[model samples]
Target chain A: MAHAADRRCVVIKADVHLAREGFTMDVQFQAEGSVLGVFGPSGAGKTTLINLIAGLEKPHRGSMALDQQTLFDAAQQIDVRTHQRRIGVVFQEHRLFPHYSVTGNLLYGARRENGDLDRVVTLLELSPLLDRRINQLSGGERQRIALGRALLSRPQLLLLDEPLASLDLRLRRQIIPYLRRVRDELRVPIVYVSHDLTEILQLTDQLLVLERGKSVGCGRYGEIVHTDAVLSVVHDRGMNNVLVARVLEHKAEDGVSVLEIGPREQGEPTGRLFAPLCAAEVGATVSISIRPWDIALAAAPVSGVSILNQVRGTVLRCTGHERRMLVDVNIGAPLIVEISRRSATTLHIEPGTPIVCLIKSHSVQFVGALGPGSPQ
Target chain B: MTPEEWSALLLSLRVALWSMAIMLVPGIACAALLARKKFPGKVILDAAIHLPLVLPPVVVGYVLLLSLGRHGWLGGWLYNSLGVEVAFTWKAAAIASAVMGFPLLVRAVRLAMELVDPRLEQAARTLGASPWRVFATITLPLALPGVLTGMVLAFARSLGEFGATITFAGNIEGATRTLPTAIYTYTQVPGGDGPAMRLMVISIALSFAALIASELCSRWLTRRIGAAL
Candidate 1:
């Protein structure tokens, strides 16, 4: 996670206000991360916000800057054209050119002197698809090519408008690894927009939540998820806590794998949790996601239970929703556990209160396996 | 066929090809404009481009004569300034056929251009391609089948051009007499039905071959682009 600090520079600053026939979008936010996930529901002007950033749509007023370069300024009457903006976009539909082969499409926007084509093709595993026609590619293959095409353009910024939305659940999981590779390998900053919070969380914890064309919250996922505005939108969608963990060992006879969660400091409060056996080698880092409601909060450890994990942690904050309460617990890494309001009252869960978090071995799902070079 | 018939057939092919070449670029330009642009007088411009499709071919020829005839405004300027003669010449025959066939070319190409997905062009722009580059690399190639169809239609129209060629360029046997005009000339004399029928058969065969060639080309192009036009 130390590499994440290098990408903390502000990538985009947009304060734009637009009003079309039936919808109006007035949002102001600054994106700073290797990947800033834009999360919102349908008709929340998510696409419009990206369009304005990509220069595909004009804002009636306000200004935008990318990497501290002025992209659009209404008071200055400066609006850079889309092509001159040098921002590559991967639309939801792939939008590949029907006339060009895979190689041609990739090279259509490549900067020849840089010679990054081979790197991009190799990174995305596109060598075999080079000669194939666009229509001949599968949904996953087409998305890979689209991503490669945008990467080869040498863009200062990348805009992904639901790049995986068109794919099925399995296909989306397949593409997420490639996207992670791009984020780690490429220097280009990315602005990924999707309505699925789980999908966004898998990429980066920093999110810009949009509700009805307005910014509800913008910050770390753990810090903002408990807010009323973000909760209402993400509650029904099933919010999950995404964490990076390192494989400690595997108990093959016991049919469970042990993983060390959170930072690797000498005196850190990292906890070892049991998960289902996975193919990842020991010492490799993997991303795991667990639903909030899957974990039960207990006042103290129980010995006679069948649960595989009962890690002790201190509660940070608790927010009561309509029927459920979201308890933020710092068990090495921050985890949001959803429990009944009655449970909170019985357990006396509040800031600085010690508690035990109950979990099952199969509750943790392996979302993705990071490459060897990526730090945990 | 006699030398007279051979000359007529060759001249008709030459005129038809020249007509297609003359109209190809402008026809595509007009089609792209009509398909992708909006401005004042768009409806009027569209109607004017399609005038030949609905109006009599003789009237179109007469209008060309009025503007580009030897003593006419544009023709006189060309004659005086550049010492160029355009009336009753082979070039005039090509122009006459091109004018008559222009509407078909524009209509087919416009339909094709209209069918091109605008999102692809937007993607290209975001990929750092200029607007013109987007048109050349994405829009035009996707609409290629329609363009081929339009060219074939214009070529066939030029081959069968009679009234416009007759009215503007006159029926000069070696210079301006295309297939239909030659057929008309042969039918005028007594006992000339044999040559007239021969020329008529050649006209039908030429049109048929052009159509079949167009269909094959469009299919191949559509397959190359991997989509139905």
Candidate 2:
């Protein structure tokens, strides 16, 4: 048996053409360990990218590989069939086999090899529903089974095409944590496709932005979210900064946790960000996502403020949009703060201005812990 | 009823039952081939399978007679090598009925095959089931209702066959005589109405029974498969 560390990367290089409903997709990219979120509008070929990787559709011209194992190479005349590729696919609609019991579907892939089955059932919280028929399962339950089914395949990589896209917001919220859990515990690389920005940001670190069947951008979400080009595509709505933070102290009595933000390279920016105290224990690593619009910048560090987070940084760049001004500040790393254009002109904020970035600590949403062996 | 009427009734039942049974395997084979597999000349094969449905029954009977009659080339070889002479025999009448009933069976089976979800078979394939195994376990079980419907339809069609039966296997008492042929014989004779009416009633009952049986079997099998409407 090989450990997770021994596995290879998934490299997809394709220039595929599919004509449908007056839209065409000509995409190509590759990823490894990091969850590569394919983000785009409907019919932009985000799902098509996953389909090509899953072997559900063939490319017109391309070479795809995983850890040097050639999956598809037009020049080499090699195309491995879907079933033999040792990859698991979770489709948009939960594609659970209606004829089989939950256990049957979960074991469908596992049975192809001789391995322990009980462990998978327990890990996925599927023990109770094992004997239940798929037709009897709720939509949420069906997706859980679909996830478990894909996991049990012991795939080298997994491809999920908007697994939660069909569910209601509450259901999507309910499944996000499970996805994060899977990503943290399992070493397999995942290629997830979704238009939901929050869901993708909450679950994945790496992202591949797609538009009109072309790859527009690819990188860590936190690093790319601040770029003017990426923000222009993201439309700079509620999307903001994703910071790698640690719980320096948790004051349960005050119902707040002090998160250490800004890299040690910048001598820690001299202030703390207040966040939800319930999500973590003291000294645990967590991800804090704060929308750019929620952050307020002032020229002076004011006293008697109700806002719990006040960080001092120098503005690196500023770009004015129709109703808002996007300011990039380098505290330790670049953070994009979206402010009203009126305020930017009134405060006279510009590049190289020393200012205090103020945000209500409660705006921080804490995501899951950094996985073991994760590079901080 | 006269002895002739009784023999004809028995002969019709025998020929229809034997004809349905004989056509079943080939009918399913043809339907499966048409439904699941793609090949060169597929359109031609489909048209050929359905020829009996479109052509006049007399034409099909004439074609059969030309190919299988005792003096025909294939017919002569069978007679000389195996001492098999099908012309004017009850077996020849059964063959004619089977050919006429074939398209009905194939149509029913093919429709059923189409109704089954292809994804189920693909799931089976991913589960490590071979193509043949997938067909047996997933395809055949799901398609059972259609197969049963086809079988009943073929049996009913064979029970009522007249033109093809007479054309290929000439009416002869206790040999090639069937219900329709006997009815013809009685109509041609003097004061034969009583026997013909009784046999006609029996024929009607048999046909009705076959239709009812098909309905019940389709319901039962559909329920057994637990298929959602």
**Tens digits of per-residue lDDT for model 2 on A239-324?**
75777676888788999888887545557555677887745667666666888878899889889989988888899888776677
Clashing pairs in 2: none
Q: Report the C-alpha lDDT of model 1 over A141-251, residue by residue, as the tens digit.
A: 888999999999988888899999999886777777677777777756788999887788878888998988888888888888898888888877758888878899989
Scored by lDDT, the top model is: 1
- For model 2 chain A, give the 10-residue run with minimal summed lDDT: A367-376
Report the lDDT of model 1 for residue B56.
89
RMSD of 2: 5.5
How many angstroms is the interface RMSD of candidate 2? 3.4
> Of the candidates shown, which would achieve the greatest DockQ relative to the real structure?
1
lDDT of each candidate versus the true structure: 0.88, 0.77
Candidates' interface RMSDs, in order? Answer: 2.1, 3.4
